[model samples]
Target: MSSDQSSNKKKNNFTIIKDDSTDGHGGYGAGTISLENMSSIIVDPNEDKAYVDMAAMHARSDVERRVKWINDREEVQGGKLYWIVWVTVDKNENGPYYAGVAGSEIRVNREIKRAYKSMAEHVKHMEKSLKGHIIVEHMDDHSKKLLGDFLRDYKPELWENSTEELTRQLF
Candidate 1:
């Protein structure tokens, strides 16, 4: 595909808020959190780029697929840093916006086939994002900019509708 087509396809991987699965019926799945609004954004600081990678939702993104996970960060010395950002979209009176954004860190050493990431932290961040919290303060400036630019360029309307907090932190 052409560059524009490729870009569009990458952008299309992001998930937008959808109708409630429970639909106010309050039945079997009522209390469960709906993930339709969430998308996983992978930020690769080494490459200075970010993109939505839906496989990341299941810990199967390209950067993560072949590595063996290690519990200790020290074990992954010289590993490249990456961020899996959970971005949740929601609609307001004005339009759809990025209502939640939380970044979780991961370090990978491709040559050694080793990676370090806290599953607990990732789960917590996901929950926090689902609740509309912004938790990207831990990310580096470059990765933050990459994420911000990706979000803005992928869908300008959503970025424009996002809160000042998102803009202020990302920019």
Candidate 2:
């Protein structure tokens, strides 16, 4: 095979075709993007596991409470459920990097799987005196609303009950 054909074969082996209609180009355009090349899709399990550990290390009571609150609400709606929300902390950053609520442990695991690189980079910008730490925060009302909005927009299928149904049931 020619070098160009070999390169094409290698590229084709790694990525699946993506439909980018909702991605602002109208639909299938002249050129397509590859999902595998996306920064978020970390392929190495070991690297991902490391990030999950980093996330767990900072799991605080309040964070647990937040996870519980949402999990409780979802469970009441019935069927198997496992959901988690995480925050990534850095020494210099002013705000918590809310990892977002994940529907499953695996999904949550993926969020942190490739975090070490960025976390390490953040450390380089930190002062010598302050120590960096990671911790999980309980979802406050705002965070809860954010999660609700995200689920509605991105993962509506996860919700068996609508907000109206939930409010009616709870209240």
Candidate 3:
């Protein structure tokens, strides 16, 4: 393909999620934009997941609850529901980056990483030095992966060598 096509492809990495309001029952439905100027759809508590929607599973309550209740409903990877909310961030007429999907794990991973970094900094300052080391424990493999995937998925600039591996198993 041409260089422009290649660039577009690279920018298409993020999955866009807009606001969805029809997920009041089974928690899944089509999307309709409420605002005109908005470029994406947003996912709400009572709405279903959809392309262009910025969706969140309440982490502890909503996501776990729904993923279980609708076990394997949209099964993709080994009977597990796989929902990919797509978004188009067109850079051509719009700007430089356009059309993509936003990985929720990415957002979550950043959040945890920020928290971890902050905690680590606080500890080092309080203890007078980070001579020992830094690490995040207590979480399970799944939780770690959830955050790891986000890091590896979106924040590639922040990942490298052992850092990626450490965070993969830790955050």
For each candidate, give its TM-score against the true structure.
0.88, 0.19, 0.23
lDDT by residue (49-120, candidate 1, tens digit) is 888888898899998999899999999999999999999998999899999999999999988999999999
Scored against the true structure, residue 158 in model 2 reaches a CA lDDT of: 30
Question: Candidates 1 and 2: which is better by TM-score?
Answer: 1
lDDT of each: 0.91, 0.27, 0.31
lDDT of 3 at 54: 26
RMSD to the true structure for each prediction, in A, is 2.6, 20.7, 16.7
Clash number by candidate, in order: 0, 3, 31
Question: Which window of ten consecutive residues has the lowest lDDT sum in model 1?
Answer: 11-20
**Predicted candidate 2 versus true structure: per-residue lDDT over 1-171, tens digit per residue:** 899967744442212224354556565564542222111111122222111212222232212223322222322342221223222222213332222122112122222221112223222212110122211132233334444443343323433233343222212
lDDT head-to-head 1 vs 3, winner = 1
Clashing pairs in 2: 48-113, 62-138, 63-138
- From the highest lDDT down, the ranking of the candidates is 1, 3, 2
- lDDT score for candidate 3 against the true structure: 0.31
Rank by TM-score, descending?
A: 1, 3, 2
Off by over 4 Å in 2: 1-138, 161-171
